[model samples]
Target: EKRTLDVWLTVNPADYDGRAAALLIARDVTERRRVEAERARLALALEQATDAVIITNTDARISYVNMAFEKFWERRQSDVLGQPLTVLGAEDPEIVFDMQKTAMMGRPWRGRLRHRRRDGRTVICDTTGNPMRDEKGDLVAYVFVQRDITRELELQEEYFQAQKMESVGRLAGGIAHDFNNIMTAILGFGAMILEKMESDNELRHAVEQIVTAAERATNLTRQLLAFSRRGVAQVRRLDLNSALREMEGLLRRTLGEDIELALRLDPADCCVMADPGMIQQIVMNLAVNARDAMPRGGRLVISTRAVSLDDEFCRTRVKLRPGNYVHFTCSDAGCGMSPDVLARAFDPFFTTKPPGTGSGLGLSTVYGIVDRCGGHVEIESEIARGTTVHIWLPMVEAVGEAAAPTAEEETRGGSEIVLVVEDESMVRDLAVRVLSSAGYAVLSAADGREALELVEKLEGRVDLVLSDVVMPVMGGLEMAESLQEKYPHIKVLYMTGFSDRDLTERGRRVPGERILLKPFTRDALTRRVREILETAKKARTHTEAEPS
Candidate 1:
């Protein structure tokens, strides 16, 4: 031993003679070192990410968090290191506890979670959490990733709303086409009866009442068509202020005394290209919603102003374009909403109220009208603070002129040999009764096939073909094409419950043509028939007069 067998030492004697030296020397640790380095690299990567990343131990205690997590929680890394993740749930700790339990069981959880920011404001985040395990497959930790999906949610809601409107439009067009035909007969008969009696007679006055009722029905059908976006839009550039002023009295009556309705209209001419009737509907629907919100009675302020939106505005708000606009604001001092409710307010059939209380199509219809008119709607609401809806319509370069009144003579027309075609028996009979009473020789048919047969059998005496669009045994379009081919001089008046585009697809043109909507009044039917027949007569005369 004193001689000390000469052992060659390449390094320190202490390093070679460590307590665990034999075991450490027997192992090759290069792969182990690489694995550890990779794990650390992954941890660092997660920590530096912008999305808040958090890891909790199996006991639901905070194990690790990235820099983003620290900022999101507004806590220092040291403070949150060993703290329970439930600490982040100042408002509701159960949310974190539940999510941790789900993840610990090897299950993943995803949902919107509410958390209190450092400033005390509520922060909503879309969160996903999954379980983590060690090499032995033991439950170790939960990894959570959270993102602010507020804007994304809003866009999704808007997309859903658009789809809903499209569906409603199709339904509305179909109903209007059928309803218009019934209206035509009702109105036509009422007009004929009224015309035969003395103005002072009680029976004549009763008939006048029928005509008035039919007219109101006609207006309703038109509204449905407008909602469906199938009705012909007579869009004109008009001042919004003047329109609002005219509607003020009507709105006051409609809202009742419970609501204190106030109109703050800017005198500046805020011109927009839109149909007056459609605009009226937009205002009425918004007012109705405002009234519903303040059921207990509150201030409803309606204001209109000129706004010039820029790119900044467009970026901040969804579905809005940067341009000059006329903004209509409807504000109500009612029970406000959480962000969740506000996001879905425009969705069709989505209502906070119990069933049978609301259809939830009010706002959806408004959105459709605005979208169809090349405008956008924005809503702002806070719980207990009430709501504000802003509708922005594009400004027009020119103002619209006042509508010209029809001449007294033009409104009156003569009875003509009218050939009426309709599928519905009730609607067909109504047209026959109404037209016959109005002093016109009317022929009725249950379908287009019967109508064409009658037309073909009758020698050159048929004046006009009043046909329904959607019918069995050949539709109105096909019938019209067949008749027009043989009798080029025969004028066709298409009546339909469907939209103009629907008929156009059947190889028929509606532009400048006398296409009547169903459920029309006696006055409307007689007037339209007269106009069509007169126009046809004029055209035939013009053709004959032209040089060959």
Candidate 2:
């Protein structure tokens, strides 16, 4: 209906008629201009879109693709246009067919789908498609939008896994705490009976057996606590190479002659801050796992090196930061795991080994330990190839070195006064009995509140406070804090069955603070008390000797 017109008017010169002539030229460009404007708008929209956009004809052949689509598929638009939709390689052909069917019916389709890139990598996408129609309501084409959701899906899985583990850990921690309380009484009474009996007495053997069994049970509880991330870690600066070398002989014996064990230490020393025993346990667990994987006989390689992870490398991992790290790797040439098995590898009590053959706690324990130490773990495996596990622990600039022990035999008992505070009756009784037997004057209380009252009444007479960290109405840390303010000279030894995180928000082991973990042996209890008493005595003596 729109047109461009050019018109001219001419006057005829001549005598008689003085005629006027008009000439006109008209051009219609309504459809051409309209199409040009639409093309420009569509091109701009496609060029600037963040989501992958694809336009396919009614026949399911690609008519056009946006820049985002090209980037996503790693393909050129010129080569892909007019090709079949199947060229994108749908992860599930049925899903693609269903989507096309729904769109052809003039209905919209939305779902999670996978497509393969030109490089052979598959991408997970939240895809949506809608049919485009002409003014007469006739279906012409379908427009699809896709957004990459690979990382989002990974994060979601991690979140759910963490929640499940946390719930399990809470249950495990409560059980371990109660078990420790029961075992303490069992072991303490058993030891006392054995100590009173004659060397040749028959009852002595029975009591000794009970004590031994309790010790074994204690080991199981410790593992439970470790998996719950509640066990206190005695972290120290470590030379990973030295530890691995020391473990070599033990590993060989454990592996047997059929399996070969190889150790390749980093040329540069890899130093990390971790519990020495725990680090050893990590290596041992991994090696044992590898040994189990290669039942028929295979080569196991343990290697260590220093590594630095950057921002990009750390992005996909949860709770990981970019920094210097010590890398420890354990690889086995054995039967590998399937993807389904690999995804649940770190879940608690998830094991493939037959009944009683595995506890399903080994890998889960490893995950908990590494997570507690501010480290990360990665696993890679293929069906026919092999499995490799990589562990990274942050590196620190400096760590305290332990002093060498003196050769002199020191007494393991002392006459210092100790206040025992615990809510658990059996555990409190055990502590009282142990300290009393070790020549120490022991005062007992049912809880921190009672301990505080006793301390107040004792008025500087109580030389040391040995209190449980958790209790009703009050806790050891609170009692200790009050004591420090009132009687700064008094030494406090806090004990707990709870994990380090429960004791402190930071989950840090405070320097120079004495803490004893529960379910301890009489000897361990006596030795620790003696050490703190002696140290306190030395400090008091030094203060008195100072000139005013």
Which 10 consecutive residues of model 2 have the lowest summed lDDT? 404-413
Worst 10 residues of 1 by lDDT: 4-13
Each candidate structure's TM-score, on Cα atoms with residue i matched to residue i, is: 0.71, 0.86
Cα deviation at 136, candidate 1, in Å, is 5.1
Q: Report how far off residue 135 is in candidate 1 (Å).
A: 4.0
Tell me how many clashing residue pairs each candidate has.
Answer: 16, 1
What candidate 2 gets wrong by more than 4 Å, as runs, is: 1-35, 100-106, 115-122, 190-217, 398-400, 404-411, 456-459, 504-512
Question: Deviation in angstroms for 105 in model 2?
Answer: 4.8
